[model samples]
Target: MPVLHALKRIGVLFLATAAILCTPGTPGAPAAADEPGWTAEPATGRAATARPYFYLEGTPGTVLEDRLALANTTDQERTVTLRGADAYNTAGGAFAVRPATESTGAGSWISFGAAGTVKVPPHTRAVVPFTATVPPASPPGDHPAAVVATEGGREVGVRVHLRVSGPTLAALTVEDVAVRGKGAGTVVAYTLVNRGNVALAPELALRAEGRFGEVPGRGARALPVELLPGQRVELTEPWPGAPVFDKVDLALTVTAPGGARATAAASAWFVPWAIAARTGAGLLALGAVALAALFLVRTRRARREPPPDGAPVPERAGQTAPEHELTGTSR
Candidate 1:
């Protein structure tokens, strides 16, 4: 009976622990693979002032203060750890944050002071204040980052779009342009590098030319990418109507807001080599047959023709010309 009582108590404790542990499906949790039943976002003082992300701007050597809101939707108290992390575009161009240990740039400048960790009761929210102290030597422009909350190995991040007041530049380059496959399967692959201090939303235009004239190409369109400063993304554009039997010169023109523009070019020969090889072999075989037939006809004609009016006839392979006795007269 005592052992049964102990087992019941242990089961209750386990259930309580599970409820306290943050799992996905929390109100403020990022819609990631794991469901943590909590949410982290920019703190809005009043419900009407709901902000999606933190936006801070200041000059160098200035400190900017903001609040982050963490909501625990579970029926148990939730304990979470807070930290700052650098934000960047993944190679696939999705917004992501670096691990806290890898934080540099603006992320390193953020501090929560004494509120680095907090415990929130069931169905409660906590507002934590944080500050970003820009160093005097910090460069001017956008330094993206995020405030991350972790509970029981599950993490949620709230974006902080911070910018240091100063001159901003928007520039980008399209590199490594190449054409792949042929016909309906053609694709143009290239890399887009952000070379300036600002984020860019790039638009791409494709043009193709053959020896005769301009061919069909894609019209100017915006690419679904948000290129971060100093980051590059490799991408591909489909060319479903690629030529089948021509040498084509492909040019890609990419442009973005704030006067950002770039161009890259590549060349590809869209020849069906398999079909060409078959056709060439057939032609070669036909030529060989024609030549053999012509040779046979000429040989028969030469054998039927009389020796050119007393010209010396050539000796046969097995017989001499009878001791040269009137070889042309009787042969």
Candidate 2:
């Protein structure tokens, strides 16, 4: 009972263990053995596109447990047989028929359903649960396998592969940082995004440019950088002025599990802000007024202009109004 209980997970699979390879089918699927009174319709089922597919969680390989679901998608009594199911090779995919390898081990971890059985009813769906096991010592990589079911004389089979991708680890992605600044003691800000799958402790070492309003001669400094998958962190560093440097470059480095590393960097423009000069305030105000005026003029024009015929209607871009009306479609 305990063994069976452990096997109930969504990732159950079965290994062939070089056992007596038994594949059955009927007349419809002649590819399968000749089973009498059994007519199989097309083995119709949707591939599980998300995790927990086939009721198994992690990447394939480690003796996952699951059952392929195939329903009678046609009228009249039809039998669906799974005979010689396996990963479709590149060549096989061209022909639309996959080549599958039988599994080898049942592993001692779990057992969710019966290893071998076949009998599908008309108008109903059948579940072919399977288990996958990654040899404890097996190297991490992609390994292929398949399951076979048979019904009728001809065979209607689906192809699936066993995956043996190695260890589970998180990944980190650092995005390019943007900065605006110039002059001494200027601070350039940047954002770091974590694109990996794992979480990371927020910490990083900083190294950035000192020329062109950059942190001059700056060494590594600690930045609080805790983040997780798809997370981001913003950082700003004060510029250290060096007479020899006109611009500064900001750089950061991060370390994670399995010796993985991530980095972000930014360049500080050397353009001196006019705000540092007395005329800077007046120039800033003038620029703002000009922008506001431009915005107002654009708005007034939009409001005053009218369509030639009826009220302007929203249409898909690139399509003319008459073309859209006639076709009842949008570009």
Q: Please, what are the lDDT tens digits per residue for candidate 2 over residues 163-227?
A: 33446354565565655444565565655554544334434566755533434344554443334
Candidate 1: list runs displaced more than 4 Å. 1-36, 47-49, 308-331
Can you give the TM-score per candidate against the true fold?
0.80, 0.29
For candidate 2, what is the TM-score? 0.29
Off by over 4 Å in 2: 1-166, 181-185, 210-218, 237-245, 271-331
The weakest ten consecutive residues by lDDT in model 1 span 1-10
Q: What would the C-alpha RMSD of candidate 2 be, to one decimal place?
A: 27.3
Worst ten in a row by lDDT for model 2: 1-10
lDDT of each: 0.76, 0.43
List the pairs of residues colliding in candidate 1. Answer: 23-35, 23-36, 23-37, 24-35, 24-36, 26-37, 26-38, 28-39, 29-39
